[model samples]
Target: MLQVRVKPGIEDRIRGFFPWVYRAEIASLSRKPKKGELVVVRDFGGKFLGYGYINPDVSIAIRILSFDKEEPVTPELIKKRIREAYDYRKRLYINSNAFRLIHSEGDLLPGLIVDVYGEYAVLEFTTYGMNRFREVVLEALVETLRPKGIYEKANLTAQKVEGIKVREGPVYGEVPDEIVIWEHDLKYLINIPEGQKTGFFLDQRNARKFVRSLVEPGDRCLDVFCHTGGFALNMKKMGADEVIAVDISEPALEVGRKNEELNGLSGIEWVQANAFDYLRELDRRGEKFDVVVIDPPSFAKNKHAVPNALRGYKELCVRGLRITRQGGYLAIFSCSFHITEQHLLEVLTQASYDVRRQVRVIAKTFQDKDHPWILQMPNTLYLKGIWVEVV
Candidate 1:
């Protein structure tokens, strides 16, 4: 195996169990290894540190695979990690089979995500190392969970950044054209082969349930950017009077409508249109709603775009507030890691000011427990939700 020699001070971080060994931290390398090749990491004094996967191009040069020198990076290790991850999920008391099983670095398995939807498992690999472990990891899941189907949903950009090519489609079990699953007492369908991030946002499960708790019978609810109708289906199940789910993608809206039916919710109205434009039109028409949900995609993938993303988010909140009835509730969210909780709250405050409305925060929430956040890593807590009452 190739050897990666760390700088004088680099041993401190690696010894402290820090997962990433950036390129700058390395003083030298004995030999150039293939991307994702397992390498022995050592300090400048030639003291053993650990084993890890190397990627020559990225700043995050190597991701430590194991701390124990004896622990082989074998299929058995993958099975053990998979087992531990599953056990942790079951402990959460979330009976739904549709949830995140492994949340990449959060689960101590960086660059990999495993979402379980009933009998199927959707795996997304975000790094070359995880991609190299694909077969072993899939075998682990199959042997441990005995899932009916498993699929791969590789992140093209992440792969590209790691100097690797994208590999699409099933890597193990047979992946059908459409996969059905249940969440928050509602049924939904997904096409992992072409669907966004395994065809649904299972991470939003808890937030949708929280929104449902605020719903009342005879209440008219509007769900903006209602990807696959998560909030809409939850509200419908909560016995809302009516539901309007809007999204830009016709195919996503179709999936949302199908999910509404799958959940036995026939009262939902699906609208295919841009959420921002729809909200503006509603404002112009003097339309009002008892409850409104604004859950848009990540507007700021890069830190530099945070400013514009905040502006966009504020505008959505402003429109949502304008169309909300007096004393109505607004469930707002920001999935962008760049948009900190404080920043989102400030944006919402400005939005309230724009509508000349006084709003009181009812509740605040972070990402669901399924997407575990490492205490030292604030980035893990990306999703933020705040319930506000327009007074």
Candidate 2:
């Protein structure tokens, strides 16, 4: 393998298992390394640091996979990591068959994501280096899950940045367009070929269940960006008399409708409109709800977008706080790593000040146990929700 050396002081983070080696950190290379090629990473003085794949063209040039000298990147090692990830998930007692089986760096397999739904598994390769192990990943997934089918999803940003080909669709066996999965007494229809983030937001499983605690029977509730009715249906299950689910995607709303009926639920008003617009309209109409959930998609894809994302989140928080009835509950979430929990709290404080409503934080929830995050990699803890009670 080609050996690569890092600049002085750069090896400290790598030794601390930071995983990523930036292009500017490299001091010398044994040869002109090809993109997506396995290489040995070393300290400035030639001591071995770790084993990783090199992507010479990108800013984050290398993603270290194995820190052990004996554990090089191999098919067997990949399979072992997959098995270990599975074992960890098994111990999670996630209360649902649908979950994230492999969380990339969290599972020590950067650039790879695997989500299991019923008997089907969805895979996404977000790095060129990891894409090279597709065959091994698929083989391991099949051998471990023995699922009826497997599907592949594309990460468009990764494709462009890592120079990997984007191939989305069924990769193995027979995968139906939709599959049904259960979560905490609720059944949802997952559109594997079309839904967002591997057919469902499994990371929000705990948050969805947690929302039920603040709901009371016959209460009025609003679910913004309520894709597939995860929150809306749960509100109804909690005996909320009136529930409104809003989303811009007509297709997602259609699935939300199906999910409602699948759970023998009725009376959830599914609205096909932009959540921002709908929230404003609700405010204009003097609407008040006992509970409100504003779970928007990632508003910031990169650090450069954080300012605009915070603006968007602040607007949502303002509207969410206004529409929530006195003594009621409101929950706001950010799925972007760039939007920290502190950002949400800061935005909420400003929103509350502007709206003149005193608020008390009720709870804070994060990605479920199945989607474990590395402490060193804050980005791995990408999802955060803040639940508050309006006073």
Candidate 3:
């Protein structure tokens, strides 16, 4: 394997279990290395740091998989990590079969994601280094899950950054276009082939269940960016009389409708439209709801986009607050790692001030336990939801 040494003082973080090494941090390389090559990283004094895979072209040059010298990156290690991740998920007691089996760095398998829905598993490789282990990953998934089929969802950003070529389709066996999965007495149809982020946003499972607690029988509820009617269905199931779900994607709205029928749920109004515009129109029409959920897609893909993302979130908070009846509940979520929980709280405060509405926070939720995050890497703890009551 090629050997690389980092600049003085850079090894401290690696020692602290920070998995990423930037290209600029490297001081010396044993040789000109190829992308996705296995490498041994060392400190300036030739002290062993970790074993990782290198991508010379990217900003994040190395993703260390093992810090122990005894444990090196190998096909067997990959399979063991997959099996261990499976064991962890099995103990989580997650309400649904659909869950994130591997959360990339969260599972110590950098650049790889695996989500299972019923008997099917969906995989995504976000780094060329991890993509090189595609065959091993598929083999491990088959061994551990014995699923009927496995599908691969292409991450466009990863393809662009890591120079990986991929097509979205089945990698093994036959995967159907849609599969039904149950969560807490609710049934949902997952379209693994075309749906966003590996068919469903399993990270929000806990939040979806928690939102039901705030809904009351015959209450009016609004679900913005209601992909597949997750929050909408829960509200209706909780006996809310009127539930309005809005999303920009007609296909997602269609799925939401199907999910409603699958759960034998009625009185859910599925609206296919831009959530921002729809919320404004609702305000103009003097529409108000007893409960409101604003769960938008990630507005910031990177740190550079955080300012605009905060602006978007503030607008959503302002609109969400305006349309919520006094003493009613409202929840706003941010799925972007760039948008911190502090940022959400600050934005909510400013929006509340601007709207002249006093609000009290009720609860806050993060990604469910199935998707564990490392303490060293805060980015792993993505997806934050803030629930408040308008006073």
Candidate 4:
């Protein structure tokens, strides 16, 4: 293994179990390192800090895998970590079989993601370092979960950043283009080959179930950026007479319609249009709904885009607030780490003041328990939502 030492101050954070070392923070290295090479990180005084894999090409140069000196970064370690993550998920006892088994840094396995949908397992390697353990990871998943098939979804952004070359297809056994997976009492069709974010937004599973409590029979509801109608179907299942689901992807909407039929439910209008434009048109038509949910894609990919992201969020909040009837409920979600819960509150406050609607927060929700987030790495806790009652 290569040996590298960081600047004096950087050691404190690494010692605190914060598992990233920026390139500029390095003071010295025994030799030039190759990308995805295992390296032992040390402090300025030559005291060991942690063991991690180094990526010389990226700003996030090193993602520490194990802080313990005894536990090194080995193929065996990857197998062990996968099993540990599986045990943790089993403990969660998620109502649905589809869940995030490994949450990157949250599971202490940086740059790896594993999501299980029924008899299949979907894998994504977000970092070049973790990609080195791909074979072991697949073997571990087979030994642990014993899924009928394993599929790899190529993340374009990760490809560009980390230079991981993986074709999007089944790597083990056979995976179908579509599969029906049930969450709570509703069934959904997941398009693994061409769907967004591993074919479905499983992170919002809890929020989808929670929204049912606010919906009443014959109530009208709106789902903006509602990929595959996760929230819309739940609203209808709760006896809402009318539900409208809007998304930009025609394929996703098609699946959403199929999901509506899969559950023997009806009256959910699936529309394919830009969510922002649709929301503006709804406000123009003076349409008011009893409940509304705006779950948009990540507006901010990185920190530089947060200002514009806030503007987008504020616009959604404004439209969501204006069209919600008095005493009705509205929920706004941000799925990016760059947009914090505080940012959501600030934007919602500004939007409410602009629309002249005083609101009180009724509830707040986050990614379900299966997607565990480490307090040391705030980025792991990416998805957050705020529910407010319009007055």
Candidate 5:
């Protein structure tokens, strides 16, 4: 394998078990390896460090595959990582048919995501290295788990960053047009063939369950960005009096409405419109509700756009407060990794102050157990949500 030398202080960071090697950390390279090539990582003094996957184009130049200097990045190593990640889910009692199996760097497998829905598992290979191991990983999962279906959903911008086109459908077994899965005793119709992010936001499973618990009998709820009605269906099951589900995509709304029926539910108010525009219009008309949910998509992808994202979140919160009855509840969230907990809280605080409403946080939540957060990595805990009661 080609050997790469790191700068003086960077070797310590790499030795300290940081999984990423930035291009700036490298002082010199003993060999020019191709993108996604397996390379030997070494210290500035030529001492062996570890093995990693190298990509010349990305700032995260090398994603460490093994920290052991002698260990090879083999299929066995991949299997071990997969089993370790699966064991964590098993320990958490999240044997649910639908859950995130691998969360990129969180699972020590950078640029890869796996979501298991019952007998079917969807694999998203985002990075060049992970993409290269797609077949091996799929074979290992099928062999070890005996899953009925193993499909691929590499339709993410991260794949584009690696100069890879989104490849959807079955890598093995049969691919379904709409994959159905269960969460918290709720049935959801997920179109992995057409839906977003492995077909649904399984990361918000626990938070939606929390929402279900908050609903009282005969209470009216509004779910904004109610894609596939995950939150809407939960509210319905909890016996909410009425639910107004809104989304920009008519197709998503159709699937969501079907999910409602799949769960044997009715009396949902479904509207297809721009969420921001709809919220603002509702605020202007002085329409109010007992409960409201704001679970918008990530407004900012990187740090540079966090300010704008915060502004957008603040506006959403303010409008949500405007359309909420006094002593009512609003579940607000931001999925952007660039937005910190402190930042989100501060934005909410400012929104409450501007609206002159007293808001108290009833609860705080992150992604479910399926998405593990590494101690040294805060990015894994990207989704921040708060149950705010307007007073």
Candidate 6:
């Protein structure tokens, strides 16, 4: 195994269990290191800090997997960690059969993600190091979940950034192109191969349920960026008189329509348009909704994009606030780690000031329990939403 030593000041964070070691923090290496090679990380003065995989070419040069000397990185360790992750998910007893089985670093399996949609499990290996453990991962997933099929979804970032060559589609048993899964009295039709983020946004399960509390039988609701109508369906299920779901993708809108039909739901107007443009149009028309949800895709993939991402968020928040009825509820979510809870609050405050709509936060939601995030890595807590009542 390759050995790496970090600069003096970098040892504390590594000792505190922060998994990543940036390329610049590295002071010395035992030898010329290869990408995706297992490496033991040490602090200055030659003290062992942790064990991880070294990816010399990436900005995040190393991702630690084990801090204990006895618990070195191995295929068996991957299997055991996976089983532990499954046991934890089972303990959650999430209302939905579908859940995030392994949340990459959240599960201490840095660089791997596994989402279970009923009988099918979708796996994404986001790092070359984790990809090397694919065989063991698959074997463990099978033994633990006993899913009808296991699908390997190729991640674009993994290919371009980590240089991880991947194979898409089913790697075990048989997987169908489409599958129907139920969550909290709502059934969603998932296009496994085609849908975004492993066919569904399981992270918002709690927020979807929480929205039901704010919706009344005769109130109107809007779900912007409503992929497959997760919030729209839940709003309608709560007896909202009218629901409008908007998204940029026509195929997603089509799926939203089917999902509505799948659940014996009707009257939800699915609109194929950009959510930003749609929200502006709604505000222009003076259309008001009793409940509104703006769940946009990550606008910031990296830290450099945070400023522009905040602008996008502010615009969305402004429009979301404008179209929401007085005393009604509005929730704006940012799925980017670059945009923190404070950033969201600040954006909302600015939007509120601009729109002249005094707001009071009713709730703040994070990714559901299935997608656990660790305190050591704030990036793991990517999905955040603020539910405010427009005053």
TM-score per candidate, in order? 0.93, 0.99, 0.99, 0.99, 0.96, 0.98
Please give the TM-score that candidate 1 achieves against the real structure.
0.93
In candidate 6, the residue pairs with backbone N, CA or C atoms under 3 Å apart (3 or more residues apart, or in different chains) clash, namely none
lDDT of 6 by residue, 231-305 (tens): 999999999999999999898889999999998989999999988888889999999999999999999998999
For every model in order, what is the number of clashing pairs? 0, 0, 0, 0, 0, 0
lDDT of 2 by residue, 1-391 (tens): 9999999999888888999999999999999999899999999999999999999989999999999999999999999999999998888888998999999999999999999999999999999999999999999999999999999998898889998998998999999998999998999999988898899999999999999998899999999999989999999999999999999999999999989888899999999998888999999999999999999999998999999999999999999999999999999999999999999999999999999999999899999898888888888899999999998
Q: Write the per-residue lDDT of candidate 1 for residues 1-391, one digit (tens) a residue.
A: 8898999988987788777899888888998678898888999999989888889889988988687889856667767888899999989977477889999878878888899878888888888887888878888899877888888776878866985566777777687889887665667898787678777887787888888778898899999999888888888888888899999888888888788777777889999998888999999999999899999899999899998998898888899999999989998888887888888789889888877999999998878899998765677789998889989
- In model 6, how large is the Cα lDDT of residue 280? 86
What local lDDT does model 3 show for residue 53? 98
lDDT, model 3:
0.95
Clashes of 1: 0
Off by over 4 Å in 4: none
Kindly give the stretch of ten consecutive residues in candidate 4 with the minimal lDDT sum.
159-168
lDDT (Cα) of model 2 = 0.94
lDDT of each: 0.85, 0.94, 0.95, 0.94, 0.85, 0.93
lDDT by residue for model 5 (116-139), tens: 887888888778877778777987
Task: Estimate candidate 4's alpha-carbon lDDT, on a 0 to 1 scale.
Answer: 0.94
In Å, residue 144's CA in model 6 sits off its true spot by 1.2
Candidate 3 least-lDDT 10 residues: 192-201
User: How far in Å is the alpha carbon of 378 misplaced in model 5?
Assistant: 1.5
Q: What's the distance in Å from true for residue 28, model 1?
A: 2.3
Off by over 4 Å in 2: none
Kindly report which residue pairs in candidate 4 clash with one another: none
Model 3: per-residue Cα lDDT over 54-146, one tens digit each? 999999999999999999999999999999999999998888988999999999999999999999999999999999999999999999999
